[model samples]
Target: MKISAFGHAWVLRWRWMLAVLAIAALPAGLSAWQWQRGEDKAATLARIARWASEGAVGLDGLGARTDAAQIDGMVLDFEARWIAPMVWLVDNRVVDRRPGYDVVIAVEDIGAARVAGSRNAPARAALVNLGWIAA
Candidate 1:
């Protein structure tokens, strides 16, 4: 095959342009994705901060919503009794420069007649994280 110099140069330029475009576009795409993730994280943090500032609410005041997104980071107060014989100690926790374990236990809210909108009125136990206990 007889190839002209202009045609060969055009092919080379096309390959280079494609390569440059790919190189430029990859970073641009990654940057846009990272920027979007950062924005999402900021929004999530703001939501958490707003929830914290609102203070604690009663368990019954939450209504019949069961979505995790709606309940996350919400502080709730309720009359709950600890379920005995179901305690867990999360080790390797540091609080106030002291090593300790975080006490976790299952608690059933007795005040709410209906918990989580259940058909049967049974006091469901929820895991609660208590203060750090000294190891």
Candidate 2:
């Protein structure tokens, strides 16, 4: 004729257990979904860096001597994706010519310039070294 205390306790605890299980499962499910989608943040950033660097290097060796303005243009073009928006930065006419050198200084300059820009220093220093812009 008496209601049992054990039965009441089970009912109270079951709800809390279910809530905890749901909270724990949500993060696990999201991570599994991300992995299945092949989304790797680090790898994606590396690829972007490589692509930007290669593009910068290619700008060099387009002519007998690389100019500072040209380097400036390359850096501006590279940063156009995120740094500056809707501005005509790189001068295609200047960079259009290919230099005789096997290695392009602009590419190396671009990589360094990008790093500098991210660090809050003007990318001009790296650009100057590559002869893409004036110091």
Task: Compare the candidates by lDDT and give the number of the best one.
Answer: 1
Give the per-residue lDDT of model 1 (tens digit) for 1-135. 233685563334667778999999999999999999999889878988987888888766678868877777678888888899889999999988889998989998876755446646787567788868998
Error of 2 at 135 (Å): 29
TM, every model: 0.56, 0.25
Q: How many clashes show up in model 2?
A: 14
| Tens digit of per-residue lDDT, candidate 2, span 4-111 | 585563234667778999999999999998996675565655666765686644323334445553333333333322222222223332333643222123222345
Report lDDT (Cα) of residue 90, candidate 2. Answer: 37
Off by over 4 Å in 2: 1-13, 29-39, 57-135
The best candidate by TM-score is: 1
In candidate 1, clashing pairs total 0
